[model samples]
Target: MAVTDPVDIRLLAALADLGKTAVHELAAKVGMDPREVAYRLVALSGSGLPLLVGVESDPQGLRAAIAGAPPSWANRPPQQQFPAPQQFAPPSHPVPQQPAPPMPPGPGPQGVPSGPYNVQGAPSGPYTVQGAPSGPYTVQGTPSGRYPGPPPRPQFAPPPVPIDPAVSTWGLPQTASWARGDEPARPAATGKRGKLGEVMETQGLEGEQLSVQLLEVQDPADYLFGAAGYRLEAGERAVVVHTEITNRGSIPFASLPDNYLELLAADGTAIGKAPVSLTSRPPHKIGVKPGETLGGHTVYVLPDATRVVSVRWSPRPEPDERTLTWSIED
Candidate 1:
């Protein structure tokens, strides 16, 4: 966030005054090497300074910054170069003193007098001493202090009042304009959607980037079926459902390791089924290759009844009953 220094400041000012100037010419005016000028320009460009546009200035638009311009600051006859030092002269006159009585409005010498004192101790202009404006005017005085009014006003129509578009973050054109049109649209978000269901029915639930995907059924029926060859009465699956998986995920465990698929029932069917440490299915390596699909399933029984029946299948990973009931809007 280094800021532009005095050199940059002068460069910018000169550029404004010169409009579109060549780098070499800019170097000359601002007193820097052409290379340095280019470097500074680049630095300024990077710093989000005023935008530089490379277009020919409209001749009519530039009239105000040129000779015989509308503004007094820019108005000058041709054949004259910049910094016209001798162009204006302050006519000599003495600093007018306090009025005789200094009675304002009642005025001896009307309004405050202006300068241009002569060697003879006389005001070069008939600048009034202290009082109100006699008639908004400047009076030039002779060496002897004889005052004379200004010459007649020039006969020229006033300059047109141009619109000022000076958006003021930078002192860029107060009259710049833009054309209108639509811009290009942005990209849409993207990702894949997979079917979530019973292990046998579910699609891939693989972990993202680098890990094994998991699908578990903690619903009581799963526990009952895993523990007991028979799903117990009033028992439901503790393992709600299982996810179809592909084990490509990185793990601290070895590629080939013991794993089990189990169903637990709320009604103690698991202990009855077999009380082995890892019961239900025999252990297998889970050493699945990428994209490999494996199936597993769970079942549940009705609660508070000796009756045992396989529960109807439902959508896997549905957020809630409401989600299942929601209708697709047209």
Candidate 2:
């Protein structure tokens, strides 16, 4: 209870819930540096607050503790335990302890220190030739090493794929396909095509193969927009176009015809879809499954006197010359 640090209290709570955790694991949970957490744990244990019952020395025991295995020293201290780190020395004076034995220059047993493994090396000791094995290594079974490599990287989950509201379609499984070194090159498209309104299939930029057909056109004086529950104005006439689209290839088609529907006037003017409509399927947001065909209607309202010479059917607005145009005029 004497510990006033909110961070220390949070760390203690984490230790309680987790039983015995490594310094790195505790640091990750509490968002603190491993060194800082280790120092604090040492201080807390030395404070006689019963936060840590005793220091673990056995390699297998420490490993079991880190692995969330039942703690060996839970309610009682170890019968024979190593000493805790010394408390902070006064600013003006230094604290002295027993000096560590000198390590011989030649290689020793298993390339370890001459004496028993000292948790902390001498305050002033020369470097010893202790080569380590390759790959990850753990110290005191605590998962630390002399030349500690980079910290473990975080694993991130992939972003969710957007769903289309038009229809229930199964998305193709994600695949990474690469051409082999000896694979032959695909021949270029000769750009062979037919006039607008003719039933023809083409591949989209995203590799979606689709077959599109502009079936019929009608200009009506009275128009009923069922969705909005409204009718067209007296002077305005509605131009409705019936169309059919099919997903011709293995890839799924997710384009809505409403976005690319355009009405071009005789004098080089463009008109968008009218606010009034009577059709149930507006082709505004629809997806078609492979080998499936869907029919829809798009309506445009224009002045009765305006001469609509053609209906341009492009995959998108601002399309290139390859886009199709149908003669809608009677």
Candidate 3:
């Protein structure tokens, strides 16, 4: 029959271009795991496609296969052994001789014996060299070929500046209204839980005030699934949750407000939202500007038997005290 899956089609196309290749090589070309590629090729062949998947032994790997075996010479007979090549003595040659010259020396330049010395000028003693500076030098203050004294050390350390608890350590304040010891303390995240339809005030990582409200929850939302041309497995069902978020502080909430919204099952399991979207229901946009409110619907697909007890929202991947949860009633 015909190949419909995009991945299979791509793999077949790459195979056609390559004519014949190993499974790993084909996988590298199509960006798939070698095991997966081999499985797919076998499956396609079983489907009556003209494909063959098999492995072959490498002839060049015979040595590796027989590793730890005795050396070839160990099994050879004495009569079959080859003799070592003979060594010949090199021919001798007479080197030329020369007459020696007379010597007349006590001390050479710099008062050093007529031998190698590291000093440039006359040496005062074993460790001291004449015409050289005696002290350390600063990098920028010293001139070329001249040494200067060590850099001056500060007399005392500067006084420590007091840290304001209200100021954020991330960076400078975003707005002029935010000043040290002037802005009110942030509200504690304790007791942030509420029921559906109740407005919950929360803060983002950047301390942006936000008002989040769970507007609606539609369980077993099969109509949205069928309308959006999507299908669910036999035992799975879809859910749609409506939420509204309003930015109350001067800073903008740049993250998707409902990105972490999940359905908490009665057994303490968290069902995350599906990646699919419904055309009729708008998904949460990227950012919510200051003083602006936006409403969006989040969709989830879970087992039909799961009893969703509450809807939870978090600014991060994991839930924390800052996370807001709204209870769902049967």
Candidate 4:
């Protein structure tokens, strides 16, 4: 049967050009898989095409197959390709050497030696020649001409030892052992906490001006939001803190202020504001332009007995240990 498939025809045409090429290489040339190309080649050979004629293990016959001509001289049969061996004539006799031209006379006095003379003309012993090293032969050494090995390595002093940190004044102080009643006193509180409904102006660590006014602190029993599908857990009350912030800085404030607000307990531990309360005005992700006032409320779910004394506000979500805080009391 005739090769009817287009892929088969393309494979046969490519094989005619690149005779006995590897399956992967031919696949890359025709943009097909190697196995698919191999299958198509088998089908085309089984078909009524003389594509294998004049083809050899070597792929050099592709040009002849593509042009519909016989293999070239190199691929022809050995007997018809190369001529018969014939005897060669013996080499001729070597050519005679010509004599070299003589050198001109030296330009020196009759008694003086010149023009690359040997040391035999001089009384040798320990005398050194002008254009040569100071050695018996032309070797690199003292006049005795005995070469020594490389020079000795240099010696370096050891480094000084480092001091211990415990005894060093610049390091941390040693911990003092205290009795049960003699425990170290806690550090005195730094800044005073502000009360509700009080407006305070504070500058952040980044030099941004912020004027905050705490409106109210609401402790609701069973906070519910039917529209956003959120409810307070059992024995958990929602502590909502309402505040208004005015961007008094020269640049616009682009951060979420709610992420920086926290509620601190009596034991110096801080609790983040809860995101479950959806029924609040001015969403937590609040941004304000220069000289513009933006107000928002943040809610937190705390245990019924947990006492939240103050609300802390900072400019960053995760502030460093030395970061400043504005404590607004409830």
Highest-scoring model, lDDT: 3
Candidate 1 residues lying further than 4 Å off, grouped into runs, are 1-228, 235-242, 248-291, 298-330
Candidate 2 runs further than 4 Å off: 1-197, 221-228, 279-285
Give the worst 10-residue stretch by lDDT in candidate 1.
320-329
The top-ranked prediction according to TM-score is 3
Q: What are the per-residue Cα lDDT tens digits for candidate 1 across 1-330?
A: 545588888778767654565565556545467778888787787788774633334443343334345465433332232432333444775555643432223212434443322333445444443343443444444334543433433334336545334421322332223211133323332122222232222222222221222244333444545565554443332333333444443422212211222222334232111222224533233335544545343332334332221122211111112111111111
Cα error of candidate 4 at position 136, Å: 49
lDDT of 1 at 52: 64
What's the lDDT for residue 242 in model 2? 78
- lDDT tens per residue, model 2, 114-148: 23334243433322324543323334443232432
- In candidate 3, how many Å is residue 191 off? 5.3
Sort the predicted structures by TM-score, highest score first. 3, 4, 2, 1
Off by over 4 Å in 4: 1-192, 224-228, 317-330
lDDT of candidates 1 onward, in order: 0.38, 0.57, 0.70, 0.55
Ranking by lDDT: 3, 2, 4, 1
Q: Estimate candidate 2's alpha-carbon lDDT, on a 0 to 1 scale.
A: 0.57
TM-score of each: 0.17, 0.38, 0.44, 0.40
